[model samples]
Target: MRDRIVRRVILPVAVAAALSAVAGCSLSGGTGSHKGPAAPSGSAAGRADPQAAAALRGVEQATVRAGSARIESATAMGGMLSLRTDGALGWSGDPVGTLRITYTGGQLAATMRALSSTSLEARLLPDAYYAKVGDTFARRLQGRHWIRYGYGDLAALPGGSGAYLTDQLRDTAPLQPVRLLRACGDVRRVGEETVRGRRTTHYAGTITPAALGGADAAGLRERLEQAGVTRESVDIWVDDRGLLVKKVERGELISGRMSATAYYRDYGVKVSAGRPPAADTADFRELLSTRGS
Candidate 1:
């Protein structure tokens, strides 16, 4: 009974929790080879307004240069999970940060409590994520309290979508709105607005399969397709310094409607993450192996 519950129910919920953290961290598009934002050359540029294009590129460059920021986000993944996360993330050319994630409500929330509690402390590194589970889960793991999930392992999970999820985590950052703007055929500035008491310029655009067709478009297209979205709407608020202050993504998925809203502040903040003690941590894969034995 314990093994069956752990394997069938707990593992999936745990994976979802880790994925929720990743997904909630950044609402941006996939990571590409380019170090900074540059206008897509050739015919693609012809379709976009030169002024709008320049504004987006400026936002991307300024964001990347800012390094890190405090982030607060709320994400709903169809009916699978809904979560709110608050923490700081650093993307100074690498994905590294920390977040305090809470499972407000969802089907996965019930199972999450079985392993630990609804709240989890997540440490994000360049290659993996470490989550701190509770004493209840620790008792079953020979006293280990942390579960380590490597990005490569996430890609090899039971479903093919695991790879897509892994890619999202790897490519996502606070500056993701700028990445989405790169694929927009018609990006327009919706004038200036106030976001959290700060004046910011609003930009809105739609992403379609047709707009994404270039050397750097493959990864972005794959991410959109995996989300079951033919078209996704993106809106962003950027401060005068060209930093992303807020972003929202809305789209239709096979399961249902999906959306996320994120607010960023305190740019250029110093942040750091340390690995859990190996001796006191367990790999998620090994935990599942105990099933049915």
Candidate 2:
């Protein structure tokens, strides 16, 4: 149970939380008062789909301008894990936030219970993230209640792809959808749709390997390849004011199929996250080293 939770639930959720922080960065369009032209419906003429590009560019600019948001998300990885998270995050330039994550169902949830609970409080900072674990797990760390995972340390983990995790946490979360759009071969407006009761413009696209290449690729292609995602589908919903309200990403990983859906709100809301008390926090790398010895 411990192994399963660590592999399937804990690690995946940590990644998801980091990515979700990025989502906050792209969804808040500065003070929530800025507005852009509405997206055109259906596919626009041209190889580059100028209409779609313009609309998404507006979303990108708005999100960067706003800088913070409240988010709710759900993620699933095949049948191994299913989880939900709710939190507020800031992405003005550096990512900062906190989340209450719950293991809702699946094998991972069962395993989490062995540690005394199926929920965790995660705090994200510019350089690392901290997870509050149950007392059962804390007992293994000389009674420490938190585990700190630094972005740099994640790169040195066992998996050769661990660096990808570090890169994503450090750089790619908020603009992942925008990157997908830039790398997509068939970006188009899917028409207007209702999301969480608000009217929004729906955009969809397919990300192919060929699309992943460019002078400014930013290593996204290599990261996707490492995860076994040859091709993936992406969907985004932008609210009437030109802010991203929701997004969905789906793809196959070497481990299994994975999907995540996230909703964003309260753009420009103030958010802050602080490091756990040093005395009560254990560095994840040290924990691993100690266990190995």
Q: Candidate 2 lDDT, tens digit per residue, 1-293?
A: 44333633364444444354335211100111113222322455224565886788788788788788888888765566667878887878777888888877666577777777578888879889888888887786789888888877778866664565666555523467766675565677888889889999988776655576444455666656665554456778999777788888765454555567888889899899888999999887775555321
Q: Which candidate is the best by lDDT?
A: 1
Model 1, 1-293: lDDT tens digits are 76557644454444444443333322222212223222222223334555876788888788778888888887765555677878887878667778887776566666667667678888878878777877887877788888887888778877566776676666546554566666666677777889999999887766665577445577667666665555566778899999888887765554455567888899999989998899989886786567554
Model 1 — which ten-residue stretch has the worst lDDT?
A: 25-34
lDDT of 1: 0.67
Per-model TM values vs. the true structure: 0.82, 0.82
lDDT scores in order? 0.67, 0.66
lDDT of 2 at 206: 63
Query: Lowest lDDT 10-mer window, candidate 2?
Result: 25-34
